[model samples]
Target: MTLHVHSMLIDGNEVAASDGAVVEVDDPSTGQVIATTPRATPADLERALAASARGWETWRETTAWERSAVLRRAAVLLDERTEEIAVVLTREQGKPLAEARAELQSTVEQLDWFADEARRVYGRTVASRHPDQRMQVLRQPIGPVAAFTPWNFPVLLASRKVAPALAAGCSVILKPAEEAPGAALAMATALTEAGLPPGVLNVVTGDPAQISERLIASPVIRKVSLTGSVPVGKHVLQLAAQGVKNVSMELGGHAPVLVFGDADPELAGRMCAAGKFRNAGQVCIAATRFYVQEAIEEAFVASFTAATRALSVGSGLVDGTDVGPLASSRGLARTVELVEDAVTQGATVQTGGHRLDDGPGYFYAPTVLSGVPETATIMQTEPFGPLAPIATFSTFEDALRRANGTPYGLAGYVFSEDLTTATRAAEQLEVGIVGVNSVAVSGAQVPFGGIKESGIGAENGTEGLDAYLYSKSVVTGLRRLR
Candidate 1:
């Protein structure tokens, strides 16, 4: 499809790249061109920064209620156009249409959450230690923000930064992933239609390094928010440090899912299958490493493999498609390499170990590998695709040691029916978020982030609001008040 793409949004108006160069966006599901976004030049980046500076001046002056009103309206508009936007997302990102719809709906909820939270950016007064003196603490917008969102969850991730920054009264210049830029543009259009003054949310697509360096160097952009890989996040952090800019980063994860011997093997299998295969396991917090207790490993592997093999792999737009193509050829190659390495190292491929060639796109079957050696390549790396490697643990302490062995500390999951055992496991997991008896973590209302090599800072929750705000303390002498 030849899409009439809105290339960029600057200063509240849709515009093209200054060099007239467009980045071709492909539909990973079909290996077809879906849209073209403007590849921003250095000049466009500078303009976006300046525009955000201008926007911040006005946006910061708006009452919290006014800002909340705008964000809430944007949320409503997003809900109204969920299908239209989700179709574009599904086509570009190659997540199943059902998942795409859920993402859009999630984005809507995120926007609404931040909007309501806007009314609660509270500051307080401290009791004066000195007589006749008063001290007050006030919260204020940080300034213009530069946000970079990844392709895996374009709409939802963009909102995670944009909504919170705007709600905290900061104007944002978003550099969305070139591979899936339409969702950002579509969102900008919705916010614009919802009465957002131009420049409050600027979408610029281009060379990430170029755009990021320019934006971070700009004194106008006070904060940077990123959702990408660990390397990319580190690079952004390094650039932002030169300007002393505040940054919020949500980076990589090779999450471990632990199944206790006492846990129901069938239940763990079903939950892990759903969590591992969603978006073809492209999720940052995906359950990539499975460590089932030895007593139940055989049963868990059988049930999980069966469930994974049952998933239908095809075009994301097709109705009832459970698994979609990898978002790029590179992802497919990575998945292939990881699986091949594990197999070559003596791991048994329980099911679906090869790439699907029935079509022209980058589709891989939902694979489940058992007896994955601790030294296998997939065991040491983040398989950001539809491949799950299962290893067995003989004891709870052994499982804990293996789970915490990796440098990644993003997310971890444990399944145990006993409340005490579940709670104990949750505490023992060395990750930012833990799912006990579940694979669902990182909700919109909670703080979402990681530790160690997974990158720094938090997004979502009240802390997310603080990410775009600064606190000011005022001391005054009330000599004549008495």
Candidate 2:
């Protein structure tokens, strides 16, 4: 397996791993080592910190228009080479080519949005109580940042962190997930081609614990942002605490969908099926649990199972593949574990209860389980794969209660014909973002985040840019003497 994009981009140049160590990237669809990324050493991180310190000095001084132009150019370059980058993305991370292209398209749109938003980081003058006093509140860049990104949606998630950081005049060192690192390095390339100066953005893929520790402890790094699992988010929180740093976290989710009796069960079922199985159900905000009104539970389950079964599963590059393999063997095993536990506990397997051994990759059937006992392991933990477990509810309160029972509160879905029921459900779902009649909830113009233990902070929209900036209030005494 060979790599299309070379790795280890530090300061503007592409380099090889120190000590000749490399980590192989496997295509999850085939379970074969597709490419090896150069591993970053602690020494390399030292250089990155030094480079970032230098970058911040110049980057923070640039006019807003200068930064905005670079980002807009990046978006244009990405659009020009959509198929090329999307091919690399699909090969590195097992999402269908079409989905990979869609992710890239979304990332480009986010860049455009944030580019225009760069000029909108406005300051305000406040009234002073004293006649001789003046006060002004301003926003400034948080300084050099260390960003950690996940393998799932590597390019898009990394862009979510990097674009806003740059838009706010913060220099960033991106440590993309090792499993799928090519697309991130490709981003570095795009930014470079778009006229960004050296060291404004850097890419490092290596040992997570080592890389995170060195970057977090560095005095020059003022902010840390991550899009990963909850445990990793907690670990990042602990490390950033030592530095007392500015941080952003977009963590794991076990999203639940509430299907009401008044809604069209068939439509809800179809939408839930698409939501659950996209990216082979590797999405952090993908709907994992379904609570349907008892009157429509059977009908929803029947329709949902049919949609799940209709999906074509295979290598993502294939022409008509609807869902690809799990990103790893660990994810593959987790899906099996959750489904088996539910089945053994007497949950009925409505469809797809086993791995497709008929292939040469890490493929698991998109599974649907009904009558899942609350005691089942899948009910408590996030499967993070193409497994949907549903239960029945008698009332609105009952359905909402079950939906809010999870420790993860990233996103929630509600399908109700009554506007009051939808609004009430949206108000009480205990999530950062709620969709009254939709399951798809992410876009460049909207804020995306979670609540409770799901993680802190938000991304996209105006708030996303604010995360990389800090507010400063300055007051001075003004005097006019005769």
Q: Which segments of model 1 are wrong by more than 4 Å? A: none
Encode model 1's per-residue lDDT on 278-318: one tens digit a residue.
99999999999999999998899989988998899999989
Could you tell me which residue pairs clash in candidate 2? none
The global Cα lDDT (0 to 1) of model 2 is 0.89
Task: For residues 77-169, write the lDDT of model 2, one tens digit per residue.
Answer: 988889998988898899999999999999899889999988899999999988898999999999999999999899999999999999999
Candidate 1 lDDT score relative to the true structure: 0.90
- Total backbone collisions for each predicted model: 2, 0
In model 2, which runs have C-alpha deviations exceeding 4 angstroms? 1-5
TM-score of each: 0.98, 0.98
Task: Provide the overall lDDT of each model, using Cα atoms, as 2-decimal numbers.
Answer: 0.90, 0.89
